[model samples]
Target: MILSYTNIAIKLALGLISLIIVINITGKGNLAPSSAIDAVQNYVLGGIIGGVIYNNNISILQYLVILMIWICLVLSMRWLKTNSSFFKVAIDGKPVVLISRGKLDTEACRTAGLTAHEVMFKLRSNGIYSIKTVKQAVLEQNGQLIIVKAGEENPRFPLITDGTIQLQALDSIDKTEEWLMEKLKEQDVENISDVFLAEYENGNLNLVKY
Candidate 1:
């Protein structure tokens, strides 16, 4: 009972601290998070938070020591990111180009740990539909694919359907609500609420009726 109570207290303290940190952070797109450094910072924060939770039989001094060490590591990395672009790249990694100049780089695909079918699927989801239409496809470090078309006009892409928001598809097409509502109305969807879902892309709107 004593141990359990102690555990609860430690967890409460850690949770409060971690929540404050997370609340202060800005939201970001999956590929490009608001702060580039947040990726590495989270891991260390997790460890410190974890140390507080596992307070079983460990002295408060020991926990403090570990927390201090983690803080040092985080500070060191932040210091390095300021002075060394090489270190920053090594930590965060660079975007891997899967397609370049209308050609698929098979070697880059392999190195990026993506199968040909997966690459094709990502491209298709992005509205490219054909590899020939893609000028460049970059696999960002955050595991999101970024595609750039060769043409001046960005082709309309479908991003929602069946009452479910397709996040991957939306990110690929950079879609918005205004565009979605217009597409829905174009398909004679008089009420957005009446429709179960709406999908748009390639100059078309696909809707699911309630």
Candidate 2:
């Protein structure tokens, strides 16, 4: 009985140590979820950490090896995201405009798989009493709701991201590619592929190049 208790204690300590190392490698950002990927990672890490502790068949050595492999994968993904915007969008997803021009965009809400009430709860949590008072509310990939309060600065939405045109964004604002091309021409950026990110804010177009 004493030997069994000692073994369990040893396993517990091993699990705790492995978890700490894994968390350090993954960084606290995984816990604070700045993207949908991070939020999913948090769930995955939670299950792995708990499983390592409770699963009797999982040896301490085996658990540590598994965690190390997972850490490598997460780190690799982060590195790739920094270098490739297309990969970033594929993994994290682009932020959706949930509320546009002081109106709830039900289509965007459906795309985000969140209800209007849920968005309202998030808004109220941010000290917003009424959704009507918002000019825009974007559902960030990290699950954050970015609000443009009424009478505040004009809401900015992505026009182009990672050299890809956001036709939906342009359609929502009643603009066309010809108009976008004209604006880009003014900026001396004649090609769409030259832009890394473009946002329409305050009735003006701001673009960044790769």
Best by TM-score: 2
lDDT of 1 by residue, 128-174 (tens): 78778876677877777878686623433235533444443444455
- Evaluate model 2: give its lDDT: 0.76
As a TM-score, model 1 comes out at: 0.58
The residue pairs found clashing in candidate 2 are none
Q: Model 2 residue 187 lDDT?
A: 96
Q: Could you tell me which 10 consecutive residues in candidate 2 have the lowest summed lDDT? A: 1-10
Q: lDDT of model 2 at residue 19? A: 54
Q: What local lDDT score does residue 61 receive in model 1, on the 0 to 100 scale?
A: 60
Pairs that collide, model 1: 158-200
Give the C-alpha miss distance for residue 27 in model 2, angstroms.
8.9
